[model samples]
Target: MKKEMYAFVVPCSARPLVFDESRCVGCNRCAEVCQVDILIPNPEKGRPPVVLYPGECYYCGSCVMACRQEGAIRLQHPLMNQAKFVPVRHAADAGEEKPLPAEKRRG
Candidate 1:
């Protein structure tokens, strides 16, 4: 009899979801609630679900919300997808009265 080895490749650059092994209960709820079907239940009992298609994840946080265990599952959006906050200067702060559009300006 011969034994075969199987390997699953997960992209290193982007991990849309992360599992906290210590906190995970492996109830498979996360996998069930995934709208994109990117996650699958692990064959081994009491182990975290597998991220079969990390790239296919919608980053919708459904899995995290479905999990009963706190900190068991988390959504990690890629750097490009993360939100950035920019400070905006109001017209008063800038000390400028911007002209309105010609159509909107009063005669």
Candidate 2:
């Protein structure tokens, strides 16, 4: 069965995301990883990822991690004004809600 997408709330007080189409490599890894279904893949065109619902973002940084590009995705925290280009692994590791990746075994 297909999972239902949610309208997750993204806290923009930290800062907002910067869209750089130039850095995007048309990878939909972010959309795949997003449980909330915030991002959608552009299949018709070059197949780049687009933020379908920014409000649904949990700010978990899963999208940033899924993005292979160095500066393709960024995380904007409430304490910071500009979104920082944090490594996906590091951001996933920082979150206590879930494990870094599905490949990583939890004991």
Candidate 3:
């Protein structure tokens, strides 16, 4: 009989959680607060928890919110999920004639 081994790998782009070791207190709050159970507490004391399944993250920011140390944990949304804003221009701003008011407008 032969023994079998397995390993799990995560792509860099799929990783959604970032831990700042310098700022992290290693309290394991992030692991405890993770809604998806992707984060695992490090067995070593005073070390940041490990991200077990980065691709499974929900980007809910619960881990970041639960961390007592500021800037310890940060949640990154995928590019497709990020919000984009474009400046809006009114008709007058674009040099277009404004439509006649149906009735006199009151302030």
Candidate 4:
């Protein structure tokens, strides 16, 4: 028998990354090391990597470390050291009791 499966949707930062063209050398190291496989290297030479799927990024800075060229890939401020996992509830879950306001909320 086949087992059941479920999927969850989550919200993440929109502008999660920025590639410094001046620092990148088209070596494709960053693309190779990314855990989420978001970075895509250009076919042409001397071009910076592209973030194909920014929302899936884990912001682990593996790309930054892999870059020996200095400041080639930056994960942006506010989201640099911060990673948010917002669980999106479906319509079926809307009937659940909502949390109380901060002033009335219990510890």
Q: What is the C-alpha lDDT of each candidate?
A: 0.82, 0.64, 0.80, 0.73
Better of 1 and 3 by TM-score: 3
Candidate 2, residues 8-92, lDDT tens digits: the string is 3444333434556778777677779987886677655655566666656667887787778888767665554346685456334
Instruction: Summing lDDT over every window of 10 consecutive residues in candidate 1, give the lowest-scoring window.
Output: 98-107
Model 3 scores worst on lDDT over the 10 consecutive residues at: 98-107
Off by over 4 Å in 2: 1-16, 78-107
- Per-residue lDDT value at 66 in model 4: 90
lDDT of 1 by residue, 36-79 (tens): 88777788999998897887887788888888999998898898
Q: How well is each residue in 8-94 modelled by candidate 3, as lDDT tens digits?
A: 545556669878989987899989888888877776888888887888887888888888999988888987878998786566567
Could you tell me the TM-score of candidate 2?
Answer: 0.52
Residue range 40-72, candidate 4, lDDT tens digits: 777678888767777788668888889888787
Mark the regions of model 3 whose C-alpha exceeds 4 Å error after superposition: 1-9, 97-107
- The prediction achieving the highest lDDT against the true structure is 1
Give me the overall lDDT of model 2. Answer: 0.64
Better of 1 and 3 by lDDT: 1
> Each prediction's TM-score against the native?
0.69, 0.52, 0.74, 0.57
Clashes of each: 0, 4, 0, 0
lDDT of 4: 0.73
How much lDDT does candidate 3 score?
0.80
